[model samples]
Target: MSTVLAAVGAVHPLAAATVNDNTPWVGPGMMGFLIVVVIGLVTWFLGKSMTKQLRKLDAGRAEQQEAEGEEEAEAAAPAPAHDPKLNGAH
Candidate 1:
């Protein structure tokens, strides 16, 4: 059994080093910075797009309101003519 174990250990010597090696790993601060940067970029792009859409919607609404106002003014009935002599006739 000892000879068999020695033979296996000799065949794969770096396996033990790979498991025991403690190389410098990433810290929480770096991870947090990456996450914040990604989120901020996404928010900036989304805000720009949302503002553009809102402005377009406002412009369309304004145009529609102006057209409706013109239609209403055109459809309105004209006021009757006033006569100064009719005021004393009553």
Candidate 2:
């Protein structure tokens, strides 16, 4: 099995050479950290912009509903008649 693996490595230049048991794998370095930070900032700004747009849409819908309600109320009610006798104005 080991010989077969060694032969495979010899045949492929891109294959891993030898496994290191000395040090354990660690986290990303400065470049990777900066990339992650940039991605997070971009995501945060996009989310904020989306929230603002949603709030605007909600406000517009609320105003439209209020206007529709006023129209309905006006259509349902009848105008009152004026009486000068009740007002004591001969």
Candidate 3:
């Protein structure tokens, strides 16, 4: 068993040498890098678009809240309910 294992180990380098950079598998390996780069660019663009949309939504909500606050302030602060006999307006 030891002799057979040693023989296989000795032939491993020779077997690996038979395949060069020009092998068919190299093309798909190169395509893997391209696919990663393409996906990264797509994700970056998508994140940018989503961030812009969220910012716009936040600004709209802030404006709506500010307007509603103004209306509530107006309604809650009306003419003072003073004693009519004291003011002589009764």
lDDT of 3: 0.81
Question: Which segments of candidate 1 are over 4 A away from where they belong?
Answer: 1-27, 77-90
Residue-wise lDDT of candidate 3 within 1-90, one digit each (tens)?
A: 556655665889664454333655536577899999999999999999999999999999999999999999999887777787997886
Candidate number with greatest lDDT: 2
Q: Which has the better lDDT: candidate 1, or candidate 2? A: 2
Model 1: residue 84 alpha-carbon error in angstroms: 29
Question: lDDT tens digits, residues 23-81, model 1?
Answer: 97657787899999999999999999999999999999999999999989988968779
Error of 2 at 81 (Å): 7.0
Which regions of candidate 2 deviate over 4 angstroms? 7-13, 16-28, 79-90
Q: TM-score for all predictions?
A: 0.53, 0.61, 0.57
Q: What is the number of residue pairs that collide in model 2? A: 0
- In terms of TM-score, the best-performing candidate is 2
True-structure Cα RMSD, model 1: 9.2
